[model samples]
Target: MSKTPSLARRTKSFQASPTAALDAAAKRLAAEGHTVCNLASGEPDMEPVAAIREAAAKAAMGGYSKYTQVSGTLSLRQAVSRALLRDQGLSYQPDQIVVSAGAKQALFNAFSCLLDPDDEAILPAPYWVSYPEQIKLAGGRPVIVPADAAGGYKLTPEALSQALSPKSRLLVLNSPNNPSGAVYTDSELSALVEVALDHGLTIVSDEVYQQVLYPPARHVSPASLSAAAFSATVLISGVSKTYAMTGWRIGYLASPDPDLIRAAAALQSQTSGNPTAVAQRAAEVAWDLPPEATRHQLAAFTARRRLVLDALAEVTGTELVPPNGAFYGFLSIAGCLRRWREEAADAFCERLLAEDKVAVVPGSAFGAPDAIRFSFAVADDVLKEALVRLTQALRR
Candidate 1:
């Protein structure tokens, strides 16, 4: 008999994301009556502000549950255009925006539109969990450029210079980065942009966490730097992080290259059409949420971030750079790795959950096996309890 419907060769080397896997394990334990503190998923635990929910409900009642323009509703696309100008000093016509199911899909569309087989995409180490898989799925090779936690896990111009090649099609950059929470300064971004331009590299900038930055840190769009830079960058973003609308899945890709934008739209149209109509309407309202509405949530995260830092500071062995944005601590467990004589971060995580009942993502999933990611998106008491459990596990 023929081998049971063999999978494609492209998926042969794929690794399932440990973040989702750990989260499921935590949930399973919780379902089995074991108390579990989950820091595996990156989703904000809060609900969208009332205005957004109300708008979604109203839109649903008004018969907005139909398919939209495949890209987005004209009004929603125009709203995204306006939001870009208002917040990032970036300008784009509505036709240049392709909205998709989530920022994940938007990113996939970008890579699919840009990469042919064997093309290279420069990805900074300790990146978002999904980037490498998405690049591989698009038939591109991910050339990981390592960054150190000591330097805040940031990619420098020198690193970019070393990573680029004639076949390099793009560089994927996420400011207010996931896992690392490293927000690239304007100067840093400017230097990298220079190197990227010199190498003829397209920049896919992920800015989903732009709104959640704390003081002394700011979010700057690389596309806003200059005409050349803007022309070379495709911006990916969504209301998921800022508006606590992960379920809404309202995300878009904006580019000055109409051809790339068109290709993304065509690809999105063939795959996942317009995002949910009700969600699109709610996301449009999210753009108009009261400043205080989001500010209150950011205030909470600020407090929780402090809690994470303080907790880790008291624990020996594990260390982390204080994140300026995003709600995760990319904590180094090198000390614990040595003390426990552990090799793979994945094994350490499995032992951690099975023994201590605390769930944190293995940093190996983010391209750094010597670290683990602890999210501060849950309740204050939950975070407090999780830290105690984490400290206990490392000691074991």
Candidate 2:
């Protein structure tokens, strides 16, 4: 008999992300007693809110161990709906919401529920590394529009208009974006909404980092701009980034369309079944908490952002665009490679890890070839140490 064949062709697009690879490498080096500073991971090192932890413990004791509705528990959905209304000024019914494993699964479910073989999804450059892979897994083509440092790594209305085609089914927008930390202003998002309206495109707004914005920067949800935009958009967000509940595995999607929510529910039922019951209960409490707790976490992240920006400034030849929000500094390291014979971004990162014991993600992973992403979600001293090592490595 012939040997068992491998999985389907789509698996090629699902390779482990460079950030994950770097994290694993850092872990291995640490296990071997090497002093490796990992700035490659996007996860914040902070703990979940106190109320969230207490709620989780209460739920575990209260026997919330059984399966909930495939979409989500009614209480969790209602909490999510109300949170969206309060925070984003977007209203939706409980039936129009679906809770999933995380924003990642919620996004995957959105694409799977909305896209087909011939559909196209437009993604802005310097996007989250998972966007294209998720699009491919849903059998949709990803049409990338490049964004440079000059534009704050954001997609303009003109760029969106040029990239949209008749076959375009969705436009994925991540405000306070992943690598660049570029936040979209209200006017900018309104212009993009007009483009989407004119072209009849569905907007998928990934606002997972909404609460982590810097003071001068604001996060504008496309769905909150207008009733039309709300009806045609799927707003994806979760507790992971906001409440520092990365291990909780709870995320939600809000849309005004019942059919889209139903489709996502059906897809999730056959795949993930349901988000954890205890997590759902815990998330409900998180959504119902006093605003002061969340404000404290935001304050901490804001301080960390400033600390990282200052540290990066000390390193010569590094050009930082001053990330307005999020805990990342997507820096241009092209000048650091001027003396290297092999000037590729990946080669630069590999050499830095080998010589300086610092792990950072190369920009090639995020569709920007001349930059690197430094996550400032770690403690201040660790961030400083990483920068020191990076400075030494580049100078060499």
Best TM-score goes to which candidate?
Answer: 1
Task: Give the runs in model 2 whose Cα sits over 4 Å from its true position.
Answer: 1-5, 339-343
Q: What does candidate 1's lDDT look like per residue over 1-396, in tens digits?
A: 677887998678787877888889899999999989998888888899888999999999998878889999988989898888888888899899989999999999999999999999999999998999999989999999989988899999998888888889999999999989999999999999999988889999999999989899999988988899999999999999899898889999999788998899899888888888999999998876656778878988999998888877866787789998888989888887888787757788888789888999888889999999988988788888998888777766
Pairs of residues clashing in candidate 1: none
Backbone clashes for every candidate come to 0, 0
Positional deviation of 218 in candidate 1, in angstroms? 0.5
Once model 1 is optimally superposed onto the true structure by TM-score, how far is the C-alpha of residue 243 displaced, in angstroms?
0.4
Off by over 4 Å in 1: 1-6, 11-14
Best by lDDT: 1
lDDT (Cα, tens digit) per residue for candidate 2, span 1-396: 799889887666576777889999988988999988889888888888777888889999998799889989998999998888787777788998999999999999999988989799999999899999889889899999999988989899999999988899999999989999999999989999999988899999999998888878988999888889888889999998888888899998888888898899999999999999999988999887766878877777778777767767767666888888778889887777664645657988887788788889999899988888878888778888888787677666
Every model: Cα RMSD to truth: 1.6, 1.7
Alpha-carbon lDDT of model 1: 0.89
Model 2 alpha-carbon miss at residue 315, Å: 3.8
